[model samples]
Target chain A: MQLKILYFGMIAEITKCSHEILAVETKCNSNQLETVLKKKYQQLQSISFKLVINQNIATKTIFLHPDHEVALLPPFAGG
Target chain B: MHKKKTVFIEGAITPDFIANSIAKHQTKKSIGAHNIFLGQVRADEIEGKTVQAIEYSAYEYMAELQFHTIRENAFEKFDLTCMHIYHSMGVVKTGEVCLFVFVSAPHRKIVFEAIEYIVEMIKKEVPIFGKEVFEDETHQWKMNTV
Candidate 1:
């Protein structure tokens, strides 16, 4: 499965890029995805952010599909 | 749902734009009350550095969706004649307008309620980010404090 991952705000600073494509097994969930990301980008482990799947906030247990849209969003400062 | 409008502006929102918006609404005689919420960038001292400006960014696809949801809910919950939201996308210097929320209604009460609800939601729910740049050009991410 190829997942399109997005990074924003401080998280993007750590990731050094705003977007990426991840290869994962179809049975995987966001929790496993987080573990993989945290290992790949060590700075991500210390930051506070929310995971969004397909434009909606996602829990760790949500299943991921191929070509799924995922975003790691830092704390919002919008007004 | 109301037709979606472009919410992101390239730079700081100018007073002339605001005044033009107000002028355009003069013909809307049914709207007796209009409440506006403007968010201005502030120069805050943090760790001995003064924030001189904020460069804003966002997951724009998600932000527009969030705005649409908030707009739909406001229309359902309030007696509003119209609502317009404008937010700055790039650098907005200290004291410049970054966010502008305008809600109009037939009466004052509903406009007040609508403005509060809409502004609160935009701050809490939208995925927009701001990088606070210090006077020396060093930067840090800004976090919304609920």
Candidate 2:
């Protein structure tokens, strides 16, 4: 399965890319995918971010559905 | 359902735009009080580097949804006649206004509470991010303490 991963803020800066499609095993959940990504991108290991699945913050180990849009969002600084 | 207003503006938000928003509300006679919150970029010296500007970005699709949610919640929770929220994207220089929140209500107390609630929600819930650029072109991510 392929998941479209979106990166924002400092996460994007460290990743050096905004969005990309990643091929992963079908059974992988958001947490597992995050671990893989952190291992691949060493910079992410030191940065704090939230994984958003389908516009909502992902808190548990839920399977990644193909239709779900995923994003790594850093801390908010809006006023 | 209320129609969503444009929240993101390119570059810094101009003072004229805020004045125009105030001017557009003259006919709203029922609104007895109006409160405005403007967030200006500060030139803070960090580790001997002076901050020069802020470059903002966001998970735009999600930010829009969050803004809509905040607006709806504010309306339900407060006695507000109307509210306007504008945030800047791209680079906003030091001392420039990046956020302009305008809230109107029948009473002064309501506008105050409503503005605080909405601003806090935006700071805590929205996925917008800011990169603080220093005078020598170095940058660091800005985090909201709240």
Candidate 3:
């Protein structure tokens, strides 16, 4: 499956791009994807972020789909 | 169902805009009280670097959805007559307003409580990010502390 991932804030700085398409295996959960991302971008391991799957915070394991919109969000700093 | 509002502004929220918003509410006779919260960018000295401004960005799609959810929940939780929220995008200099939240209610107490609740939820739930730009053009990401 191919996932469209969005990067925001400091995560975007580290990833060097705002959005990208990554190919992943079917049934790959968020944690597995996190590992894959951390390996790809070593700086990601040092920062705290959350994975959003289809606009919802992925607090638990969520299976990835090709059509799902994934986002990497750092800690919020809104008023 | 409440209509979705455009909450993102391209730059700092000016006093004129806020005044206009309040003026437009004059026709709302049922609203007895209006409480507002304005978030200003603070020039904080961090490790000898002074913050001059904040460049804000967000996952806009998710942010709009989150704001909508917060608005809906506030309506369900409080007896609010109306509510409005606006946040800055791009650059907002220090001492300028970055966020404006206004809530109107038939009573004074409800507006006060609802304003605080809505602002707090926006701080915690919204996925907006701020990049603190320093005097020398250096920058750092800002995180909200609970």
On TM-score, the candidate that comes out on top is: 3
Give the Å error, residue A58, model 2. Answer: 0.3
Residue-wise C-alpha lDDT for candidate 3, range A1-79, written one tens digit per residue = 8899999999999999999999888999999999999999999899999999999999899888888899999999997
For B61-127, candidate 2 gives per-residue lDDT tens digits of 8899999999999999998889999999999999999999999988998898899999999999999
Query: For residues B57-140, what per-residue lDDT tens digits would candidate 3 score against the true structure?
Result: 999999999999999999999999999999999999999999999999889998988988999999999999999999999999
For A10-47, candidate 2 gives per-residue lDDT tens digits of 88888899999998899889889999899979888987
RMSD of 1: 0.9
| Candidate 2 lDDT for residue A38 | 94
lDDT of 3 at A34: 97
DockQ of each: 0.94, 0.92, 0.95
lDDT for B22 in candidate 3 is 100
Q: Where is the poorest 10-residue window by lDDT in model 1 chain B?
A: B109-118
> What CAPRI-style quality would you assign to candidate 2?
high
Better of 1 and 3 by lDDT: 3
Clashing pairs in 2: none
lDDT of each residue in B1-146, candidate 1, tens digit only: 69998999998999999999999999999999999999999999999999999999999999999999999999999999999999999899999999999999999998988999999999999999999999999999999988
**lDDT-based ranking, best first?**
3, 1, 2
Arranged by DockQ with the best first, the candidates are 3, 1, 2
Per-residue lDDT value at B96 in model 1? 98
